[model samples]
Target: MIVDKKNDATGVLLRNGHIVLPDKTYVGDLRIRDGVIAETGQLEPEEGERTLDCSGCYVLPGGIETHTHLQLESMGTVTADDFETGTRAALYGGTTTVLDFATQFHGESMAEGLARWHKKAENNCYIDYGFHMALTEWNADLKSEMASIVEGGISSFKIYMAYKNNMMLQEDEIYDALSETKRLGATVGFHCENGLLIDVLVKEAKARGNTSPWYHQWTRPPVFEEEAITRLETVNALLHADHYVVHLSTADGLDAILKARSSGIDVIAETCPQYLLLDNTRYGTEMSEDFEAAKYIMSPPLRDKSHQEPLWDGLACGDIQFVGTDHCS
Candidate 1:
């Protein structure tokens, strides 16, 4: 392809290979100008500044990872990966964008929490990134602050059912937040598990001298997750809320979502590859040490293999619409 001198172009051609376009791929040459795909055709013009000759490799768009926690200050320590290191690793793994969360602290303004997160992330990220507000608490001020966050292009909010002693809100608060988000046309996400039940079980396990990583899964079993999802769904129904369930790890939890969606509640649920592939057994085995245990220790703790097939089926059938990394580094 030839262009006029005024039409300055930097051309790249991936010849004789599949180019995964929006709808389908075709064997052809692709030309770029000013970061936009200028043209696609045979003998694509080479008014080239630079070019990559993809003679036989698959050409695909970069991936988007929606859920990640890097340098996240939670439960008394910062996350293992800082923004620079984590974003570098994400780039190495082919993810070009991340939707990370900005967590609000109790007794602090949401704006301050967002600014804190931004300061931590702004200069360190290598690729594009955005924020989702994680509401550690819901008060009248924070509820009103949600509108400003939406206006600022941060439109998604998250809450938890699990981190009850610290981050989780009560049922009434959850209902209020969900209802407010519905009116604001924002999406709400949840970390759904029963913290109280898990705490009691953990205490009992420790009393029995079962304090290893394996006991982590045993303490906060899958039933707690299932029960939390059911409860959250009921609260959402009462408010007619729109929500996205994040990192759903158990069969029963996903089933509650499936049942809710079938009944016409706008509850969108998702799971990560780790949940589909890993199991609770790891906590007992590989992640038995203190630092190691902390690494694999996440809320909605990993479930056993019995939950795997249903999770995969949910993905295949579109019951689970999105695949996020849940990549907390």
Candidate 2:
């Protein structure tokens, strides 16, 4: 049995379920009032309260999705799911909160980008939401706005090492942004892949007339990801700032992060299910012929199956802190 809080204003009482809490788990009763958990542990149904029998269910806290791209414009296209659809899907999956990126384009102000995202999400999201500002360009003016943005509740930021002409920042610009974020006590997330090298590789592939989607994986191999992460490590080693690596896809990149953390650099990372459960073989003959391979074309493209075990081990040992979907939709 289940109670629909949307229809029942009185409240809900759930009985005889496995309640999972931070420190322990037990079979207990839980109550919710006004959409928030009101009590737990052998709770009794109040007068006029709605009740649900949870004989064999695991009641847990709602999830927080740390990475998502909703209603975002990139590479001449916008992602399929806007805030409304995306947040609704998240809620259906038990995720109660989401953090989507509000990206500042190359010539745009950070504030303007933030405003654009707010306009897209306002009164549209089905659950709690927040933004991580993705800064494409760093300048005196943009740096000046960091404090106010942080004050306005956007404390984490993102920078791309890929997407060269459209979103990537120069090494110096990245360094300066890191410096400013460190001073403001904010965190920065990175999309680490060597964009310039990828461009050269892409041109080489096209010149060979290998323009199929399979070439997408071939051109941007794991080495480029390792190289970019190593470069960022060098920068962060000097600054000692708290940083996050998003959608880490390769074993070599994970090794670099492990090395950085061992040396006391405050760096953490996340990998998506695609990296753990899928592999580069998706770009092989069968999928590519149908253009289904296009679905797997993403930055730091999927890696060899050999990389999966190490990533799983990393998660088990706490080397990787979170598993985000990098949910583009």
Candidate 3:
């Protein structure tokens, strides 16, 4: 296990291990004191300091989970895990920092929404946490509010392109948010989906008497997300701004990001473990009686089996930038 700087005065050391960093990994001895890294490489423990044998283990920085929904109220249901439970679980699983969304409701101010999230996680988190403001209404006032928000420590903002009738922002609204945030040196993330189209499809499916949960996947196919991502990137390219696409699930979507990058757009893709390990097969079929599949249901829903391997390869070749759990539970 890797030792992290959490307990400031607890002296902990890991002996003989491979340390992983952004550019390379190397054999070293890492030590921590008072919640700070005291030394690394060719280090001998003090007379009474504690040490753990890490001969074959890889000592890496704490995992930073970039996409998670804790204490989130969505889809007419409150997500099961709140900050207390979620952060504890993340720590147990080796994650030390989490960036969760502070969803600003349609009529509220950004600072109000951020403060609400802060109240929820303050003194409740086991590790560090950062909030990404989820902007719904983009206008002159909210654009002005973005400045203080960045100063308050939440430097990233994201727009939803997937929940049209809900939290999703429109084309012009998206462009406005990106432009304003970019001007503030803050990065924006997107939940890409052609929400207008999917909204129509969902209505049509329900009109035709299809009410099963599986219809979730049936209505919002990969094209919804892929197209939305491409559209957002096209807009972003015009702004020449740096942006991140969250929970990217489809091979086609990755292809769009790759194509944009080829033209000099700084597009970053974040993929969750579910996208890499799960696929549409879990939906079974219209005749199968496994409503349990709802457990796997999420936005940019799982893709085909054919896309999984390519995601792994994308990670290996730098086409993809990072891995997150998109942990909502």
Which candidate tops lDDT?
2
Better of 2 and 3 by TM-score: 2
Question: Over the stretch 1-329, how does candidate 3's per-residue lDDT look in tens digits?
Answer: 22345553558888898977678888889998876887888688887778988888898878898988898887689889999889889988889999999988878899889889989998888888888888776778898898899988888888888776677788788788888778889998888889889889989998997766667787888877779888998888779876899888888889888888888898889998999998887877665556587677777777788889989999989889999887785
lDDT for residue 273 in candidate 1, whole number 0-100: 86
lDDT of residue 325 for candidate 1:
78
Q: Which candidate leads in TM-score? A: 2
> Model 3 off-target regions past 4 Å?
1-10, 16-18, 21-28, 41-44
Higher TM-score: candidate 1 or 3?
A: 3
TM-scores, each model vs. reference = 0.90, 0.94, 0.91
Cα RMSD of all models vs. native, in order, equals: 4.4, 2.8, 3.0
Worst 10 residues of 1 by lDDT: 1-10
lDDT of 3: 0.84
- lDDT string, candidate 2, 20-70, tens digits: 998999999999998899899998889999999998998998899999999
128-147, model 1: which lDDT tens digit per residue? 88889988888899988888
Candidate 2: where is the Cα deviation over 4 Å? Answer: 1-9
Error of 1 at 127 (Å): 0.9
Clashing pairs in 2: none
lDDT per model, in order? Answer: 0.80, 0.89, 0.84
TM accuracy, model 1: 0.90
